[model samples]
Target: MSETHDHSNEHDHATHTHDGKPIQEDPLPSLEAQILEASVRELLIEKGVISADDVRRAIDQVESRTPALGAKIVARAWDDSEFKALLMSDSDEALMAFGVDMRPTELCVVENTDEVHNMVVCTLCSCYPRPVLGVPPAWYKRRDYRSRAVREPRAVLQEFGTQIPDQKQVRVHDSNADLRYLVLPQRPAGTEGWDQEKLARLVTRDSMIGVSDALAASDIGG
Candidate 1:
């Protein structure tokens, strides 16, 4: 006889861990790109254009960014309509209220509604809002994703398991030069009266990138 199952229970059992360390079963061989980067960095240091301390500080800054910063802003927007309105109106100002240091970069917040679905891409390169959403995913930097996202967004999103309704219009925003786009996904159902911390848990990096929707209540054990 077939048995009823709680998929969440199975999910818990399938958790993969490495004892709080990264698992590097097979390290990648050095590539020409890596050599090029090293050469350029050393050249800059030798020329006194940038110091080794500058390089270390840059790496540390990049490592400090995480998706949690974006999630907090998303959760606050979900909780306050005024904040949402301000965010959509002026993302830089709205982000400043949350103590997000955008500095010298422009951010545009796009809202996902019942009638419109938004997706972000960098046609040229991975010019993302690193201060807010951390580093862009590896797939986000792929040529296939960048090209296909603008050409066939529906199909692209479908491959990511984000099927927009037939009636909804899919809008693709390309990040170029200085402007970067962030998707403000609609709050998931069955999460009414939830606090910002709890709501933040529903937000994911992909959702902010507009590749997927926010997690549902059941998906995160509401």
Candidate 2:
């Protein structure tokens, strides 16, 4: 279930629409946070720090980046070994090809192996890789998940309908402000000779989040 090790900095999705638009689950800001944000925006506008048009453009850009972007990265990794090596080692450099900059924080890519299954959680707060994954789910930001994920991760996975094999070791990674984790899910079998586009379709936001495996060939009627 859980292991005792000095994994202080060990780390690091689930459901989502397959289209370019990723569903934001209860993404509304709290009243207090909203008020504070509005006040800050007004102050910035009043001081000429930023114009209203700038805000609109920024929002558009953020919304434009979706899980599809993450899917493309995962697909390339599955198809090309060279790209996978670069993604695992130099994520920032690899992500630059997608114009994603993990500024003020670095991305730690974790791979799910035959013996180990990886899951990511932010114990203190939700520090996710928004540049690629878009917004975090509402359940992710809840107190229940933050506490239970480290304490009873297997149970949590089961709740998400993911049942791991008994022989596999479940390792929970905790994400912090400076570092964010992304799970590079193991590609399914029977996908040999598949192109990147076909492979990308198998990659889901949930798989990259480590809550589930990538869509199998059978799932896609392949």
Best by lDDT: 1
User: Cα lDDT for residue 169, model 1?
Assistant: 90
Cα deviation in Å at residue 76, candidate 2? 0.8
* Per-prediction tally of clashes: 0, 2
TM-score of candidate 2 against the unseen true structure: 0.83
Single out the weakest 10-residue window by summed lDDT for candidate 1. 17-26
The segments of candidate 2 whose C-alpha lies over 4 angstroms from its true place after superposition are 1-30
What tens-digit string does per-residue lDDT give for candidate 2 at 127-169?
7888889988877877567767888889989999899998999
lDDT of 1 by residue, 1-222 (tens): 012234334322112222222211222333644777899999999999999999999999898899999999999999999998988898878888877867787888999999999999887657898989988898887667777888889989999999899999999998867777889999999999999999999999999999999999999898
- Which candidate gets the maximum TM-score versus the true structure? 2
Q: Which runs in model 1 stand beyond 4 Å of their true positions?
A: 1-36, 43-50
